[model samples]
Target: MRLTFLGTGSAMPTGTRAQSGYLLRHGDETLLVDCGSGVLNALARTDVGYEGVDTVVLTHHHLDHVSDLAVLLKARWLAGETDLTVVGPPGTSDLVEETLAVHEYMQGRLDLTLRDRTTGTFDLAGFTIESMAVRHSMQCFAYRLQPADGGPSVVLSGDTEAFPELIEFADGAAVLVHDCSFPDDVDVSNHPTPTTLGEALAAAEAELGRVYLTHLYPHTEGRHEEMLASLADHYDGQVTFAEDGLTVRVED
Candidate 1:
């Protein structure tokens, strides 16, 4: 499986980064996680497209994570396609309904399957998607995606602070895409700081294979290298700073 980072910026966007969007592809099936601003444009830079994306998994209702959802839905309808499935937290169905309600003209133009997921695993195409409740302001969730064919798994910790449950979500995964919203010394609430992430990684040092930090704020712009060095002390695995358009292949 290959995972591509479409947007690595935080709630606020920078000149180089967009927001929080990632694309996971295995064979013909493609899944998108989070559709922030500029996500569709970012996908244009790659071989993926609205038509090729079969499922969209959302972490929360934060605008930075879901602002462009309506636009994506509209574009798919205009392109004469209709099969799309969305899996997210409790408010996912309501959010989609409200988004479509505002664009009432586009309602019913496409067939959409919305699943309001909280916890546990579900089958999506050929993958087993597991969600865990995360510590965030709003109702948020982190996802663990494992291919049914038995390959390396990936965990995406969407917009969350460092919580004990994260280790469970990332257990035995090949990659952990975590939210590192602030620098090491910059303290914040409901978001992971480098220091907090460091502590978390220290506890799960053996279980993780690779750690990639994303959802960076402008505060972390010039300190990417420093963050990696500090995190390396806690996590023995490869530590990478996620950038827009960055792609990594998962191996078992």
Candidate 2:
């Protein structure tokens, strides 16, 4: 399986990174997770473009995470694509409905389906997937996926503060894309600072493979080394900041 970071920035744009989006490709299956503000063009830059993707998995309803879902749909519709499946948490149906309501022209144009996963394991494309609730201002989930054909497990932590449950959920995975939204000096709450995230990882002692820090805010500018050092102070693991267009092969 291969993972591509399409957008790694937070609500605030830095031009260098888009919002929250990722592209996952395994065998012939493709899944887009959390299409944010600039992700449409970001997707366009990928080899697959928007046409090759037929499914999107959203982690939460925040604007920075979901802003470009409609744009993707519109782009696909314009290209004569007729079907799309958008899978998300409990409020997905309402989210799609309300979104279409706002853009009345898009209603009934495509065979758009919404799947809601509140808990438990489910199949997505060709992957066996599980999800867990994370610490966030709203109801959010971190997804764990293993390809049905056999591959290393990959975990995508949406937007959450560092906690045992999130770490435990990602335990043993080959890769974890977690939110490290700011440096230790930011004094954040919902999102994790380097110290908080490192503390959480250290406390759990889970073998979380190579963890990638994402969901960066502009405040993280020019301070990547210091932030990484801060996280290393508590959790001694291979951690690095994720950037847009960064592709990583998920393998042990």
Candidate 3:
């Protein structure tokens, strides 16, 4: 399985990074997660075109997470690729309907399916997806994707605060992509700092293979080294900071 970071920045766009988005490709299936602002443009920057995305899994309905959803759908509709599936927690269908309603021009032209799920495992495009609720200001989720054909699994932590459940969700996975929004010294709510995330990982008492940090904010601009050092203090594991267009493969 290959994971591509489309946009790794937070709500605000930086000169280097965009908002939160990712593309996961396994075999011939492509699943896009979190179509935030600039996500379509970022996807265009990659080899995958808008028409190649057949499945979309959203973690939450925050603007930074779902901002590009309508645009992607519109583009796909224009390209005549209307067969699509979007899965997320409860309220996903409602949000889509509301978004389309706001943009009446594209309301009746899209043909897609919407699934609203909470905590369970389901099959999609030959992959088993497991979702778990995470601590956030809004209803959010973290996903674990296991290939049905048997290979290394991948876990993605959406916008969340440091929580032990997330560690368990990522246990034994080949790759664990988590949200590290700020540095240790910054006082923020509903987002993980390196120290808190490291402590939570340590408490889980499980082997989470490799950690990739994403969803960075401006406060974390010059504090990458300090954050990594703080994270190392509580948990010693391989960790990499995510960047837009970064691609990683999980080996079985």
Report clashes for each candidate as comma-separated counts: 0, 0, 0
Worst lDDT run of 10 residues, candidate 1, spans: 201-210
- Look at candidate 3 and tell me the lDDT of residue 239: 91
Model 2 regions more than 4 Å off: none
Candidate that beats the other on TM-score, 1 or 2, i.e. the better one: 2
Clashing residue pairs in candidate 3 (N, C-alpha, C atoms within 3 angstroms)? none
Query: How well is each residue in 72-122 modelled by candidate 1, as lDDT tens digits?
Result: 888777777777888899989999988888877887787889988879988
Give lDDT tens digits, candidate 3, residues 45-144: 7777888997899999999999999889988888999777899999998988888888877766878799899888999877889998999999999999
**Better candidate number, 2 or 3, judged by TM-score:** 2
Order the candidates by TM-score, highest first. 2, 3, 1
The TM-score, computed over Cα atoms with residue i paired to residue i, of candidate 2 is: 0.98
- TM-scores, all candidates, are 0.95, 0.98, 0.97
Q: Sorted by lDDT, highest first, which candidate order results? A: 2, 3, 1
Best-performing candidate as measured by lDDT: 2
Q: Model 3 residue 137 lDDT?
A: 97
